[model samples]
Target: MTKDTMSIDTSAELLENDILPMIREVHTDPDVPCASQGDMPKALAEPVAKKSPAQWAYERIIMYIQNFEKQLDNDHEVGMGLAGGNTGVIRIEGLGYYDPDIVTYYGTSEAGAKTQLIQHVSQLNVTLIASPKHIDQPEPKRIGFRLAAGLERSEDVTT
Candidate 1:
């Protein structure tokens, strides 16, 4: 669930490590998957993610940031991927404080409800939802990964 079969190098040359912390819009709710009753736990199956789809997407980005905070090293890399234009890359110099967000596209027209759904890197409250990943072999892609400091957490974790 870490590196891909073919490594894609993303050198950290975007910004200086002397970047300051930005108080981005705080996020709380998590992007919980509506798993089938059999596939999910008692708590997950419940109605937890009451936030609007936009909020859910934002929390997902925050979760990704918190999880990746642990696995990546000081010399780590970053890149850009598209989730229907719902994502933007935010690299903070030397610190791996990546944070992806979800921009809302109110109307679903020919433009195709465009919104940002990024996989950002940052800290988060453990009270949020736990990792929403499948334990199956070859873990799913880290669409919403988090990188909290220390090993008592998941690499692509949320809470």
Candidate 2:
């Protein structure tokens, strides 16, 4: 037989016997090498939650403050208020001249000299600057702070 006729006859024979590679509706395990597109298992993907840069900085600042508070000596006391209705004061006690560990100050006029002494103490100086640069933004909503500890030691002073 001629080559063309011989190839056509062979193809016809293969088709009749169902020996050609035909598509099969097979369900295979993902681990198997012969797994088809539909038979392959889905990937175990997880979604990650993202936080804004400002929010991330805020969280980090909070964590750092918390850790610092935890490491502080138990004998110390902390007091907070605004100075002259403008500057914010974070008072750290136990570093003052008062016999008691804590010292309370009101508006600098009330405890002006004592407050100055407290501010100068190397051990009890807790300065927190809430600059707009901390969050890398020119503007921010009303800033707020929390005192997890301190405001203890009602030990001394007047007014």
Candidate 3:
């Protein structure tokens, strides 16, 4: 076989055997049901051939967030604690990744004001928390599944 073809085969083998396993091992939580490699959305899993670091981090984080939400009672929803200051937690309503570097979060602050945090992948530090759902609001919708679905749709359009 040609050198290029052999290298591509080696890369795919490494990703399947080494990288995916390490990700599963590191992110495994005893309390939450983590998504197995097989459970990864086709858009996210199949397109790993070319992705930015921020995109990779975003996809993995989405899986973890989805798993964490599964363990929450209806009375609680997922919130994210930002790093580096008195920046309070935000209810994670939406998440996005911008090409090679940025990860953006959209949600409401503790006081219920709309908020968004745009962060570099290098500085991304996330702490997912289960916060009490607002008294008047119905159970918060799980954003992870929605996000994954969006990825699928976008992939469909691109391909």
Output the number of the TM-score-best candidate: 3
lDDT of 3 by residue, 1-159 (tens): 776664445767776853442454444566546566446565565545477777877877787788778788899999999888877999999888888889989999999899999999999899999988989988677887677665566453122
Worst 10 residues of 1 by lDDT: 35-44
lDDT of 1 by residue, 69-126 (tens): 3344333423233334433332221112222332321111123333332232232221
**Candidate 3: lDDT over CA atoms?**
0.76
Query: What lDDT is reached at residue 95 by model 1?
Result: 16
Per-prediction TM-score: 0.26, 0.23, 0.78
lDDT of 2 at 153: 18
Q: Give lDDT: candidate 2, residue 159.
A: 10
Ranking by TM-score: 3, 1, 2
How many clashes show up per model? 26, 0, 0
**In model 2, which regions exceed 4 Å deviation?**
1-49, 77-86, 91-159
Runs of candidate 1 with Cα error greater than 4 angstroms are 1-49, 77-79, 83-159
- lDDT values for all models: 0.30, 0.30, 0.76
Q: What alpha-carbon RMSD in Å does predicted model 3 have with respect to the real structure? A: 4.6
